[model samples]
Target: MIRKLKSGQYRIYSRKVDPKTNKRKNLGTFDTLEAAKRHEQEIQYFKHKG
Candidate 1:
């Protein structure tokens, strides 16, 4: 099983950041862990498609 983030979000590799940033940005807040992974996968798919 994949690791989890907040109950509302995902710890998606794409959404992870170092502790030195000046901003906070998360990919999406999902209703379920499954949904979060799906969102992450979709983003990667489209990102590689372009």
Candidate 2:
């Protein structure tokens, strides 16, 4: 999932909530939504690559 921050930046988060913290893990923060989305896809690809 992608969220817009108060700083006008975009953040990528895990789709599932963490059981330990009860919050989505912060995958990464990006200056632009497009970059965040691209990174999200890369993450997904790597996750399923194996």
Supply the TM-score for candidate 1. Answer: 0.54
Candidate 2 C-alpha lDDT tens digits along 1-50: 99999999999999999999999999999999999999999999999997
Residue pairs whose backbone atoms clash in candidate 1? none
**Pairs in steric clash, model 2:** none
TM-score attained by model 2: 0.96
Q: What is the TM-score of each candidate against the true structure?
A: 0.54, 0.96
Best by lDDT: 2
Report the Cα lDDT for candidate 2: 0.97
lDDT of each: 0.62, 0.97
Q: What's the number of clashes in each of the models?
A: 0, 0
